[model samples]
Target: MKKTILLLIIISTIISCKTVKPSAENNVLVLKGTVEKMGMSTFQYGTHLLKTESKTYALKTAIVKLDDYVGKEVSITGSKVEGYPVENGPDLIDVKKIVIK
Candidate 1:
């Protein structure tokens, strides 16, 4: 009886445990484009920019350090870091990786 109770406790503990998920705070998206322009300002993500084949997006959620990848053709995976629909500007994105392809 004691052994069964102990086994049950262990199983319950394992089943109840939760695993952490990666931060989905930023809405991740992918874009391919040239570094048409870039800038930094006192914003949420410290201000970053990219001009894609279709449109331009801004990185403005959390300060992203991507100065090393300016003026290059690349693919970026990040979240739509910031922006409002009415006042169209760049959507702040937290870049996951910059691939020169």
Candidate 2:
């Protein structure tokens, strides 16, 4: 039937138009921002924050303490721990290297 064929075509078109989210695994991300600590209400410890132009991301670093970078501009290279479309709060990332700017 023509109606059945049209329905199938519409379904295929809709499925093809859907967007897919990028995987964070093994994908290095470079972000520039100021390092700062999240407030007490965040319910997290040993995690800092990178305040960028558009979004603020939670920074998890084991190499260097974030206290030294606080209030200072820095460029960080790391892989994302959490993807965008964060519902509750900022996205999370694991820092690999940091350079003061």
Candidate 3:
């Protein structure tokens, strides 16, 4: 009984750890980065930007006020808006969720 309880506890602990990893697949974009206000641009679409290690992303959202999380590292889950990245711009993501780290 004690061994079984220990095993169950170990499994539960492992499963409880949920990490938000950055990924882009099948028009779904999951990423972690620092949020910043969008600088001057010719195309006015997104309100903010997310900068990661390798790439930067233009971001927009109606779910949450992105202005609250500016200059902080965050994890984001969003969908790629159709017809973006025009003329060598970053991919535009319609953020559904934002979690500050």
Candidate 4:
């Protein structure tokens, strides 16, 4: 009886550990760094910029609705889109939060 109960508990725990998909309500990965460069033209959506590590990324529309957030320290989060940094790009990241830090 004890072994059976233990087995059931383990199985339940494992099943409950599945990863949840990022959603608009809770789909923001916090990022901290100085904004290396911001997109100047309207072609780029939602303030596209890079981090200190030179990684290119963009904030989702939820955070800020501007194409200028350059040269500033910021903390933001958004759904990670596959292809970004392109003009009029299809890459879309669902932002959850953004904070200047």
Candidate 5:
């Protein structure tokens, strides 16, 4: 009876455990672009992104809370995080600083 309970507990623990998601917070990148709000719906708030001549990057961290510079051109320093594309999709960045151009 004790062995069965222990096995059940172990199984339950394993089932309850969640897989850790991988992140790209460690890869740093420097970029320059204009800030733009993004989303599909008109009523919902959209995400902020940096638009460059050749690419767009989803900006986070530094600019997530600050919105004074929207639609303005600026240079930013940040890290390349997951979900950003290296060749096609908009790059993802955790912005550290922004310099207006």
Candidate 6:
């Protein structure tokens, strides 16, 4: 009887556990362009810039070194940070993954 109850409790606990996902992953957006080191900026943010045919994005990442991908055309997956495009700058993205094209 005790063994049966313990087994049931363990099963319930396992089933009730929820997987945690990164907050940034929830707003996944993709951008493809050539990356370049951002020059001097008075209002613009981010360490790098991605220029596409239609738009541009300012990008920063804590997961990897974006400098390695500078001057290279790459596809990036990221989330837009809130309160961005400030001062007529490009949208800021928290880069999650980047792949050279």
TM-score winner, 3 or 6? 6
Query: Which model is ahead, 2 or 3, in terms of lDDT?
Result: 3
Residue pairs in candidate 2 whose N, alpha carbon or C atoms collide under 3 angstroms: none
- Score each candidate by Cα lDDT: 0.63, 0.79, 0.88, 0.59, 0.69, 0.88
Best by TM-score: 6
- Model 5, 32: alpha-carbon shift in Å? 1.0
In terms of lDDT, the poorest run of 10 residues in model 6 is: 16-25
What digit string (tens of lDDT, one per residue) describes model 1 on residues 53-93? Answer: 77877644334346666788888877754344224445666
Model 2, position 56, has a per-residue lDDT of 84
TM-score of 3: 0.70
**Lowest-sum lDDT 10-residue window in model 2:** 17-26
For every model shown, what is its TM-score relative to the native structure?
0.55, 0.64, 0.70, 0.45, 0.57, 0.73
lDDT (10s digit) by residue, model 6, range 19-98: 34345556899889999999987666899999998998899889969999998999999999999989889899999899
Candidate 5: tens digits of C-alpha lDDT, residues 27-92: 556787898876553222225778899986776684445386788888888887654554444656
Candidate that beats the other on TM-score, 2 or 4, i.e. the better one: 2
lDDT per residue (tens digit) for residues 1-101 in model 3: 99999999998876665333434455676899999999898767799999999999999988989999999999999999889988678889999999998
Q: Comparing 2 and 6 by lDDT, which wins?
A: 6
Q: Tell me the alpha-carbon RMSD of every candidate.
A: 5.0, 8.2, 8.9, 5.7, 8.3, 3.7
lDDT of 5 at 38: 69
Candidate 3 or 1, higher TM-score? 3
